[model samples]
Each structure stands twice: as structure tokens, then as C-alpha cells.
Target: MSEATASPGLPSRLLADPEMVSACAARDFAQIFQLAKRRGGFHPSRIARACELTPSRVGEVMRGKPKITTMDVIERIADGLRIPGHMLGLADRSWERPAVPEQRQPTAVARPVQEDRPVAAGASGDLDEILAVAAGTRVTPTMLRSLQASIEDYWRHDDEHGGEALRPAVIGQLKYVKGILRDTADPAFRHSLHGIAAELARLTGWTYFDARQHSAARGYFTESLRLAREIDDRPFIANVLACLSLQATYQDKAEDAVTLARAAQDSARLDGGTPRLLAMLYMREAFGHASAHDQAATYEAIGEAQHHFGRIAPSDDDPAWLQYFDHTKLTVDTGIALGQLGDATAAEPLIAEALRAEPTANLRGRAFHTFWLARTQLQGLKVELACTTAGQALDLAAIVESPRVVAHLREFRRSLKPYRHTPAAMELVSRITELGS
Candidate 1:
């Protein structure tokens, strides 16, 4: 590799990994020639001659970039000694492909003529009567559930259509539910409402964060905390706090993350013993300490997290939400903290183990682990692999409805720019940018 190929941004580890190098070598040179011909006006014959590959082989390379199985082709091309090889690998390796374009629905144009009309007498009469009757009925869980379901459906639709058309409806439903929850007097109803409110807050916060409207996300999270407090649902409260703490951590606010995690720990402590809650609290604290580069504190937090994990019993009657917290989850967090502490070698095995243990981990959890792995790979200068993993995470995050997942994805993208020219890294960056847009 020449000076140009040895750019500081390239992952240093790329040279050490036989698989990655082989993938580079086996990259299709045909695709590179075609792209060069189309974009740079390089003749295919010339490129083929330079790489010592037949024109037909060059063509095959072009078609194979998307399905290239070996990294050697890419490596050979990257070394700049093989013209056709360089062309093919470079063409498909520029960036990850953008998401498949969403199908657009046709809409009818409105007529220009407009007329204002008064409501009929019966319509006005019924409106007042209906309002009077509706005012007397208490807001029921069934009604709340209906609204919640509607919000969820709209969100799903938004995910498909970029959320433009459904955002207003989702926000409206959330506001209405919040108002109803505020006025309800029943304890059980309030508890259910609190759960609903936390979810809404998380979703709304995610929406705002996706829009880069951090202030709005902060407000929604604040409201979520308030609702969690109202019902005195300590476990749920801790969950909400964990979300907030993660937001701060991704924003590089280590102190804030620490404070929020400690608060969550205190809330969990009030309920006596809950292994899952303790694990969450300690994991969050470890993340904060890792961010701050406080190795001692990070290790201490990890120890606590491990202690909580050890406390879990097969026969314990844990809450439904806590069921996801297991040895895999703990290991994932440990890997994340270790990665942050600059121990990629130690971190990689832990992360791989976690992924294997929970192949179908929840969307948010998967995102967390993927982002951490990407970070670790990047630090070790494994640019292509880092980007690949990040791209996987972006796909997972698109389907996940959690603010915390979105936040982590955003951080992952930010961390990839140093090696943005690497095929995998570039691909990840483009995907995340498009998703945010």
C-alpha cells in the first residue's frame, strides 16, 4: 500500500485479518472497471489489461461486488498494484447501498374552489349532548389501550413512510393519553397509565432525537420521569432513568450519566432486592465510568453488575420486563465497558459470546451490543468490519421503537467518520444518514 492507501483513517487491523485481506483480494474487478468507465471514463480494456484479468472476468467482478465472499480481492485492489482489482473493489466498496426506496402512494389533488358551510341544526345539538355524556365517564384502561394501540400502529406506519404523515397523529394520541392519565383518580389506572406514559415518552423522545431536536427529547424524558414518580412504580422508574442515563452517556455527558444511574439505583434500592434492576443500574454506572476513563470506577461498577447477575435464581419470580436480563445481557454490558476502556481484544470475545448466546436479542439490546462492537473494532482500526456491524445495527434500529437505540445508532455513526472512505464504514454512514433523514 502506498501513502494514499495508508491513510490514517483506514483501519490498521485490516492488514492483520486474513479474512478481511482475502475479501479485499477476491473483490470483483469487473465492477470496478464498469464504475470507472461510467464515472471516470476509464476504458474497460485498459483496466482489464492493468489487472491482468480478462474483460469477462472484469464484468463478473462488477456483478459480484454485492456478493463478494472473500476479502482478499478487496485487499489486492486496495494495495493499488492491480488496476482491475482496484477498480472493482473500489467501485462497490465506496459506501453501503442506501435503503431500497420506499414505495410512494398516489394522492388526489384537492379542488381549488372552497366553500364554508354551517353545521346542520341536528349536528350541533348532538355534539353538546355527546360531550356532556362523555364528560361523566371515567377514562378506562381499555380506552387507553385503544389509544396506545393506535399510536403504535401509526408509529409502525411512520417507520415505513418516514413518519411524516403519521407523526402528528401519534403526538396527538400521546398528548390526549397524558391528559387523561393526569386526571384519573384510581391507583391501578394510574399505574397502567404510568406504564403507557413511559412508553410514549420513550417513543417521542426517540422521534425528537431522530430529528436532532434534543431539547424536545429532554422535555419528553422529563415528563416520563414525572409520570413514573406519580405511580411509584420503582422498577419502571428505574427503566425510564436508564433510558435517560444512556442518552447522557451517548452525548458524552459522563457526569450526567453517573448521576442518573445512581438515581435509578436508589429507586431500585427502595424496593429491596431485584437482581435485574441492580444489574441495569450497575451496567449503566459502568458505562458512565468508562466514558469518563475512570478504570477503577468502571471495574467497580462491572463487579457490581456481575454480583447482581450472580444473584439471579432460576426459580425467582422476576418481573416480565426483567426476564431479558440474563448472563448474556451482563456479558454484553461488560464487553461494552471494556471496549470503552480500550481493551478491544478482551471485549471482542465477550461481545461475540453475547451475540451467540442471544442471537435474537431484543432490538434495543442488539443495537447496544452492535454499537459497542463497532466502537471496539474502530479503535482497533478494523474499519470495514466496524462499518459492517454498524450497518447491521442500523437495520435493527430502524424497526426498534426505542429512543435509547436511536441514540446509540447516532453515536455509532459519529464514531465511523474517521474511516468514512472504507467500504464498510462508508456504507454504515450512508445508511444511518438516510435513516435519520
Candidate 2:
């Protein structure tokens, strides 16, 4: 019921109005414009300022000359006007909250971690104070590139250290980028910003996914997808879809996972995405098929995945996001898909090779892959070896606070129920229990 104090976001009363809610739900911007004008003293110029629309565009919308269909613009309006995300089918905007007092502003602000150095973490009241003091500056290409580099750093840190600690920074940066997007007027600059925003959302969602927070993950993935569509970026769209598909697989929504993965494939194929990108999508599809218990379809998808991967050359212009999907990743994924089909004997060697080559920095990935390897080993009746492998996985998982990793380790422990009396099983169980406690 609180209004956005620093932002021009809607007041509780107007946002609560049935008619305003109806307009937002329908995405009827013209009606929204009229209502803001009538109820909130948001005249055409104010609406233009609040929503990041040109005055002419605002006029057109007011006259109902053009219906607003662009997702990015709609999102800007929603944030600027302070409409809650539920009505507009979005994740809650960073600005959607009660007004904070000036005395409390400094404490509420938290900046995104943009460099290698550690910084304090909090919300945008911090940004507002900074932007207010540095208002005349425009976003530079250098600035955008810097932000992108930070994203790559985040990915590296996340891979090695897990996502739990990075979650706050990731979300804070996402909110920051979105704030930058509002003030940036140049189309070229906005386009790049939108890409950053999309990637950031995906990363934030990924952090949530790592924590086994599927609902939060889905929301940010959806946000990323919408932002990608805003710029008609097919590769990014496919990436977000693939993220959703993988989340669905983890959530046990097998059929839905397949549907989402196929949709990602369609998007990836549209622009003739890089071999690596297509390969990753196919792997996701394979995961979905395997989860669905469709052995033949799973193998077919894995074949396609490898086919595309084989085509990847050094000169292939792959997106930065797909850089993590190298040969080791492909091998492990293939193993996992095979394991899903209950082919543990065949899956074992493949996973072992990949685990040996897995980068030391990729602790989380290594832990996850090791879990699958242990699963395969257990299925093949190598109980002692499985226990050893599971111990390694548990140690790695313990190093990084990943709920998904812990959950898998817990599941593996439960699987060891039959052999709980064995020395290897007893040792592993004791270690896991100590860690859990």
C-alpha cells in the first residue's frame, strides 16, 4: 500500500483503483495515460518524463492513435508509474515499494558490485543520491562494456564460489541497469542496455535457480525473455527459454520442460545461432526428453547436440553467455542425459573424463557433475565407488552454498540407505550428516 517515495511510481490509491488495475492488466497504455493524467497530475510532459516516452509518443497514445505493444516501453511505464508487477504480468520492479524517509535513505541504498573490489550492498536510494549529484552524465559505450565485463566476472565467481553470495549483488546490479535504461534516450545505447538488462536478469534468475528457488528463478527468466523480445534478440531469447526449460526439468515438469526447450530451439534456429548455442539448446532438449522417460527422443536430441557441437569452430562467433559450454560441458551433459535414461554403465566413463578435465574454479559445476557421476556409479552397483564420488561432491558442495547441490547430495545419501551398514556408506553418511547439521 506504500508509494514509491523517490520514483514517480503510482500512489497506493491510484494503483488500487479498479479501472487503473484493469488498464494495466490489459496493457492499455492509452487508458493508463489518461488515468495518470486525470488522477495523478501526470500531464503529457510529466508522463513522458516518467515513462521515458517521447512527448509525441505520449500524445499519440493519449489520442489512442497507436497502441503500445513494445514490452520494454511498457515496462518503463510500469516502473515509472509505480504499478505493481502482478497487474502487468511482470516481476516486481525495484521501485515498487513504500516511500522511505530522507533520514533512512542512505541506509536503504545499495550499489551493484561493478568491479573486483568489495563494496557495500543495499538498494537504489543509494543510486538516486549518486545520480542526483551526477545528473548530467550520459551513458557511455565504455560504461556499457564495463558493466558487461562485470557480468562475465559474476559468472566466473558464480561458477567457482556458487551463487548464494552473488545473489544480492546480481539483483542490485539488475535494478541499477534498469535505472540506467530509463534515462538513456539513444536507441543504440538503449539497445545495448536492454541486452545487459536481459543478461543480468538471466544471471539473477540463475542465482535463484542455484539456490533451488524455482519460483524466483522463473520470474527473472520470464523478465529476461520479455526484455530479449523487446529488442528482437533471438539468441538471448533462446538462452532465456533454455534457462526456463532447465528449471522446469529440475522441477520435474518434464513435458513442460520439453515444450520450453523446443521453443528455445526454434528461437536459436531462427537467426542461425552459433553452433555452441544450438548445441546447448539441443542438450537442454535432451535433458527434457530424458526426464520425460523418452529414451529414443533423448538420444536423438543428444545426437543433434553433438552434431552441432562438432560444427563449432574457433572462428565461430559464439555469444559470451555460451562460452561456458565447451567440450567438457557437452561430455558431462551427454553423460547426464544417458544416466537419466538409466544407462549408468555407459554414462560412467563419459562423466569421469569430463570431471577430470573440469576447471578447478568451477567448483559448483564440478560438484553437480560429480553428483550425476555418483548416481551413475550407484546404478551400476559400484556402491563403494559411488560413496567415494558422493563424498567428493559433498565436500565441493559444502564449499559453496548451493541448495541444488546440497539437495542432490541429500538425495544420494538417501539412495545409500540399502548399504548404510557398509563402511564406505557409513563414512559418507556421517560426513553428510555432520555437514547438514
Candidate 3:
């Protein structure tokens, strides 16, 4: 198409404006979109269409959902908006040439993403949690079940995406559960509500741990333990202990982690531990051992974990929460423990196998397993492969809002210091730095 026939672009004056310049340099698309609207009389829809992005996506960018970072996306924006390559920190785009105007491919307008709480498919999505919370409506068994289902969804999303986004919702649910627990007169209601409260408190605590808010996490975890103890829920007590163990391991309190894991195992044993439960407990212990750099203890705990895991049959009556700790969990966990113990040679294949079994929905889990895989590869001196793997992990981690992933990526970055000059490592280092900034 001739220049005259082409859609008119943003005015050069707008692009040259200091605000525009700063927003571009900072890659603050939110400010950029708002500036375009306020100063250039451009609507988000037009910007989305011009950029081959959905109007909803443009809205999300304006709302600051996720940053536009991938090179392809940045380049596309450069071409679509007629923004100079240098403005986006890229080499000159072909479309910048006078003789080579860019071809703007059309993108289907995406429906705006909804933020409704998760409900089971085909079930009546009739539970108005927001309504109940506001109106102080009497809770029912059905509502409890609904909350349980939603809690499962919370865990699922927490695994897939990071927990930061879900924190508010979970805490709201926790408050609701606890409030109901306080006022309940019926034994059955009290029992059920107590269990739910314990679960919610523990879930909130896990989210705090993921955010690296250790103090907040421990407080919630202690609350969970207290609630479980109130009802003599041995299994739940064990579960909370396992959670605390993992948190302790992350905090570098390896001895405490090991002791907590042992206590969890003891509690599970008192409750006639399911094979899967024992397996998970042992895996927690393995993590503790690995963190302490106790190679012998680490392998022993890993062996025990795998041994128990192998005994788990399809018919076993494990706790609902233990359902998440399946074969895939054990595989990835074993590999991580091994890697942490400096036996990366034996860890890489296991992590890879676990990744293959993982559903794409679990983005954070994939990021985590991929990180271990990359670390193992690096340990084996496969620097380029490690860099590529780490890059993939970071890409998966980027959209997820977990500082835990960021911390892990930082450690990975430090590990790559020796190979910092290599192209792959340099690219990864740059990518990691960009993510931080």
C-alpha cells in the first residue's frame, strides 16, 4: 500500500515527547498507552489493532498485568506502532525503511479476561462468595463443599501461576471460614469448619512462603497447627508440619527442617499414614538433608520417599491434598533433592521425565522443575544447554508473580558467573537483569 493509503501513525511530536520517551525507555506500556490516549487522541482499541494485539490485552497492558518483554513482541510493537527500533532498544526494524512499509496482520479481538472465582464445570456456579462475605450469610455444608472445591482450584492456580495474585482471595476465604468457625453451634458444622479453616490458614501460609514472607508464613502455619490440634486432626497436623519443614529448608534452617519433617512423619504414622503421605514426608526430609549438604542422609531419605511412593496403588485412600503428590511430584522432587546434594548427574533425566508428565497448566511447577534441570545441566558443564534451559525456565517464570522463582533465578544467574562471557550465558544474564529491572 502507498503511504497515503496506509493508516496514519502516532504524531512524531507525541513520540518525541519526554513522557513518551521515558515510558518507552522504561518499557512502561501502561504509561505509554495512557499517554497515547491523553496526548495523542489514540484509543486503546486502535493501539491494540495496530499492534496486532487484542483490545482486552491492550487494556491489560494499561492495567499493568504483565510486561511486554519477549523480543518478538517488542519488535512487533516497533513495526505496528511505527515506533523506531532504537526507542524499544532494538536494531532498526525493516518497516522503518521508506520503501518497506510494514504489513499489519489482523489479530482476532480477544474477550476480556474475567476474574470470577473458580467453580467446578457443570456444577451450579451459584455460590456467591463475594455476596456471602458482604451479607454475613449463614454458611451451609454445600457452601463448605463449594469452598473446598474452590480451595482445590486455588491450589491448582497457585501451582500454575504464582500465589501473589491469589493471596487476597485466599485470605478473604480464610477470614470467612474462621468467622463461621467461631459462631457455629453444631458439632458437625464446627468440625467441618475447623478443617476448612485449618486448610485455608495453611494455604495462606504457603502463599506467604512463596512470596518469601517468612514471618507471615510461620504465623499462618502455627494457626493451622493450632486449629488441627483443636480437632485432634493428626493428618492435618502432619501436613502443616511438612509445610513448615519446607519453609525452614528455604530459610536455611536445615536442622529445623529435618526435625519438622520427622515430626510430620511421626504424626502421619499415628494416623496410619498412607503410602503417598509417607512418601511426601520423606521427600520433605530429603529436602532438609540436601539443604544441609548431608549426601548420605539425603539419598537415604530419597530412597525412602521413592520406596513409599512405589507402594502407592490407585485404590489407596490418601488425603485429598495428597492427591497433588503423585508420581510426577515424586519424580521432580527426587531430582531436586539429588541436585541439591550435588548429584546432578543422576538428577537431570528424572527432572526431564517429570516435566514431560506435567500439564502445561502448571506453569510455576514447570518453571521450578526446569530450573533444577538447567542447574543439573550446568553442573555437568553443558553451559549452552544450561543457558537455553534456564532461558525457558525464566520465560515460564516471567508472567508468574512469585518472588521465589525470582530468587531461584538469581541463584542460577550467580552460578553462571564463570561462563558469563558465553553468548548463551550473556543472553540469559541480560534477560534475568531485564526481568529484575
Candidate 4:
């Protein structure tokens, strides 16, 4: 593609070149790195930063000394470079879709995206119809099954779009489910209903957190934990506690964060949760430790997380919430931990890779990670480039109503104070002000 036709904010100067595009499509990272450095005037470090790899790793690839065999890494490189997905043997490119509006509720006509995983097919319709149909009928297993599918639909939508857009719909369904719990006379189905309620509460809490409503998020988390405890769902409790720990970390309450994270780990120590779930807990612990600036403890937690994660197999009976915590997410969390510890050299590439690996449909997540890249860029003294990167994140922030993004960007603006005298910095400040206005 020509520069004129390339996606916005992409490294078009490189990606627009047909030869480079072909190399990316072919997964020839060595050639791509070489050409980008020689012809594109990008340093190996720049390439490493863009690809989220260590300089040594980039050198190994360029020298053909290290095997570039991991599909995850290849996908990250492809994604970071904005290579067309079809060029990389993927079915679709993320940039093809426009930003989804937050207010668009799922309807009867909503169709599921075809993927390898199980999803609710034809689940785009409103739940009011389902409720209307089941008005006089008793709570049947089939009804619960349909509700479960509906819950999955909202979950998928929240992942694709930001929580702000899908919160109302999810809340509506949740309220309906609570009504069922109140009216249903069957004791046998109460546990199942409670399980779904806990899930709904957790999702709601997550959305609130995503939106930066910390108080509400914490309240919902508490409710979810209570419901999970009522059901004796140790795994679910562990997950919710981990979430609380994450919130605490974000809030800068390091001690509380660490305490909650450890509690989560202890709650599931008896194989009550899947290995992947335990790994997630350990990852949160790492985050807490990193936030507290405890380097040794941080790395230890990360190692433990990886240990548990390495034990996961395709047959593991993990929960739905654990689906997004794969190798890619682990890499992202590790980068964030390292970044928090002020190790920009070690953190930059990993953060870059995570940004590339983020799905286009997940605009909110992309925006959040992009902010991190800009933050890292600033720390590395790449002022002009950092502004440009921050600008891209700002564009995304304009489209997504995420309070977390808003908070992060504001903090980024504060970071630019030292560079306020520079033209680029001033211009960026002006743009950010305009964004807020």
C-alpha cells in the first residue's frame, strides 16, 4: 500500500514500501529489520522498540542466529509494523473496522464473529424479549443456558468495545437475572443463578474500573466476592480478589495491593482454580510488587506466574475470564511491571510488542497500552516521537469514553512539563487541552 492508503498513525514510511510489506507478509523479520535500518533510517534500537524485542534479540534475528519460531512473536512484529493481516496469513486486518459507538446495543440481528472459540451465535438481540417469553414459565435449565449465552455475548462485546458502551446493556441483563433469582422457587438452580450473578457483578466491576469509577468498581467487586463466597466458589473468589488487588495497585495503595494479591493466591492454593487462573493471580502480585518498587519481589512473582502459566495446556479447564490472559497478556504485564520499576531499556520493547499484539477491536486496551508506549518514549528522552505516539493515543481516546485513558493521558501531559519549552511539546499540550475541552 502507498502512504496515502495506509492506516493512520502507522509507520507508513516503512510499511508503504512494497518490498518491506512483502518481507513482513513472508515473516522475514531479519530482512525487514535490515531493510528498515538501512533504507528507512531506523536504528536497530528503534526497530527493537517498535517490535518490542531486546536489541540482542533483534540482532539475533538479523544475524539469523536465533530461531524466530514463536507464532506469538511473529504476530506481534506483524501487528506492530501494521502489516496487513492477510499478508501475514491472517484472515482479517484490525484496522478495517471503524470505531464502534458505545451506545449501540446488541439486537436480534447481531451476528457472531466466526472464530475457533465457542461464542453465543445470533446473540445480538435484546434480553427483554427473552424475559418476556419466560414471563410466566418456571426457571428451566434451558432458560439458564440461554442466559449464560447472553452473558457471553456481553462479555465479548465488552472486550471488543470499551465497557462504557456496553455497560447499560450488561446492567440491564444483570438486573433481569437478579429478578429471576428473587422469583425462582427452585433451590436447585439457586447456585447456578448465584454463579451467573457473580460473573455479571465481576464484569460490571471491571467496566466501572475501566471507566475510572473506582468506588463503584470496588463496590461491585465486593458484591461479586460476597456472592462467590456464598457459593463457596474459591476460584471465583480468587479472581475477584486479584481484580481488587489490581485496583489497589492502580490507586497507588501498594501495601493493600500486595496484601490482596497474596490473599488471592492463598484462596486458590488448593487447586481450586485452574493453573492459568493461578498464574493470573501471580501476575497481579507481580504488578503489586512492582508498584511498590520491590524489584526482587516483583521478579519473583513474575517467575512464579510464568511457572504456573507454563503448565497450562489446551485441555485445562480454565474460566472464560482467563481466555485473554495468554502469552501476549503475560508479556504486556511483565513490560508494565518493568516499566513501573523505571527500567525503560528493558520495558520499551515488551510494551511495544504488546501494543502491536493488541487486537484492533480492543480499542480501549490499545489506547491504554499506547499511552504506556508514549510514557516510555518520554522516559527515553525521545520527546518528538513521544508526542507523536501520544497523539495517536489521543485520537483513540477521543473515540473511547474511558476514564482510565483520560487519567493516564492527563498524567502524560504532566510528564511533558519539563519539555514545555519545546515546540512539539507545546503543540502536544495544546492538542491535549483541546481533547479535554
Order the candidates by TM-score, highest first: 2, 3, 4, 1
Compose the digit string of candidate 3's lDDT tens values, residues 1-437. 44335555677999999989999898777888888778776688767655655677678778876566534345546666777878878887665657756797676886676688674445334445555557664765357657878889999889888888998999999998887777666554576678788999999999999999999999999999998888778878999999999999999999999999999999988867878899999999999999999999999999999899889764454556778898899999999999998888899999999999998888888888899999999999999999999999999988778898989999999999999999999999999998888
Runs of candidate 2 exceeding 4 Å displacement: 1-137
Sort by lDDT, best first.
2, 3, 4, 1
**RMSD to true structure for each model, in Å:** 25.7, 16.5, 24.5, 19.9
The parts of candidate 4 lying over 4 Å away from their true place are 1-137
TM-score, candidate 1, is: 0.57
Listed in order, each prediction's TM-score against the native is: 0.57, 0.70, 0.69, 0.67
lDDT of 2 by residue, 1-437 (tens): 22324345656898889999899899888898899889877778767766655678789788876566545556677766768888898887665556586564455668665988654435677777666658633676457657877998999999889888988998988888888888877664687788899999999999999888888999999999988888898988999999999999999999989999899989977876778899999999999999988999999999999999999865454555788899999999999999999999889999999999988888888999999999999999999999999989988987887889888888888999999999999999998888778
Better of 3 and 4 by TM-score: 3
Model 1 bad stretches (over 4 Å): 1-129, 132-137, 144-170, 182-188, 209-212, 314-319, 359-368, 381-384, 387-437
lDDT of 1 at 284: 95
Tens-digit per-residue lDDT, 1-437, candidate 4:
54334443245677778888788677777888788678765566655555555577678678865445444355556554556667667655455457586895668697768889854435645455565566733665456667777888887676656788888877887787788888875543566678788999999999999887899999999999988887677777889999999999999999899999899888887444667888899989998999999999999999999999999865454555568898888888888888888888888899899888777877777887888888888889999999999998999898877878888888999999999999989998998888778
Q: Which of the two candidates, 1 or 3, achieves a greater lDDT against the reference?
A: 3
